[model samples]
Each structure stands twice: as C-alpha cells, then as structure tokens.
Target: MLRTIAMGVLVGSAILLTLIVFRKKLGWAWLSLFGTHLILAALGIYIVNFSGLLTEIYIPLNPATIGAVTVLGLPGVIMLLGLKITLF
Candidate 1:
C-alpha cells in the first residue's frame, strides 16, 4: 500500500525529471514514460488488491502477482517501455 504508492511517486518523479531534461527533443519518450508510469501505478493497485482481481481477464497480462514482485517489476516494465520507446 504505502510502499507501492511511495515507489510509484518516486519513479514517476524520476521520469518527470528525465522528461524535463529532454523536453524539446524527446516528446515521444515523454509520452511513453507517462504511459509506463500509468501502467505501473495501475499494476501497483492491482497487486495490492490481488484477491479482488483474481478472476479478471480483460487484460492479457495480470501484472499483480504479489506485493514484492509488483513493486519491483513495475520499474522494470517502465524501464523497458522507456527504452523501447526511446531506442526503437
């Protein structure tokens, strides 16, 4: 709960800073970062409430397996998304 929100905030801030640093040249990157953060935040909530979404199949991948994994994996996904959007 608290951990996920804190981490999301921190990760979001970092992404925001990166976007600011590359404001003019990386508009696409910024948008992707924003999307990735959104995903992370969603995943965080999903994880924290796993018992509730156990049967949801609307999304292909259920990112919220457990708290620790969700907390750690979100940043990885975000980084991958960022890299994919920025590099290729």
Candidate 2:
C-alpha cells in the first residue's frame, strides 16, 4: 500500500512537472511566483540574522535551514524559529 501510494505521488508530480515545463504561460508564472517567494524567504532569514546581533539569538544559515526556508517561504522561517525556541 505504501509503495503504491508513493508511485502514485511520483507519477502525479512528474505529470505536473511536464505540464509546467511545456506550458509557456504556466512556466513563466511558476518561475515568477517561486522566484519571488525564494527571495522573500532569504530576506526573512537575513532580517532575522541582522537583528540577532542585538538579541544574540538567530537561526543559523545552514543548507538545511536555507532549503527549508526557500521551499516553504516565510512560514518555514517562522516554523524554524519556533522549533529553535522550543527545542534549544
């Protein structure tokens, strides 16, 4: 059952990727939206790090944290900060 579900998800993702790549308008829209989101995510982290100088608390700029922020945007940064507060 798990394998079947994974395969279905994989196939669906592949289909979506193909559609995005082939559709010109969709491709542009996808690029612009995600590009903006990635920029916002990086900026959010940068702001936090900059302010950290005063607070002495900040999220480390590692690949894992960066990737999480890049993929999930502002919410990802918030979630990471929350995790740091609760766990560390």
**TM-score against truth, every candidate:** 0.31, 0.59
Cα lDDT of model 2 by residue, 2-68, tens digit = 9999999999999998887897555567778878877787788889878755375588887788889
The list of candidate 2 runs beyond 4 A from truth reads 1-20, 23-25, 52-54
> Best candidate, lDDT-wise?
2
Error of 2 at 30 (Å): 0.5
Residues 24-85 of candidate 1: C-alpha lDDT, one tens digit per residue = 57557766766676576667545534646334322224444333234456664444444445
Clash number for candidate 1: 0
Overall lDDT per candidate, in order of appearance? 0.56, 0.82
Clashes of each: 0, 0
- Candidate 2: the clashing residue pairs are none
Write out the backbone clash pairs for model 1. Answer: none
Candidate 1 global Cα RMSD: 13.7
How does candidate 2 fare on TM-score?
0.59
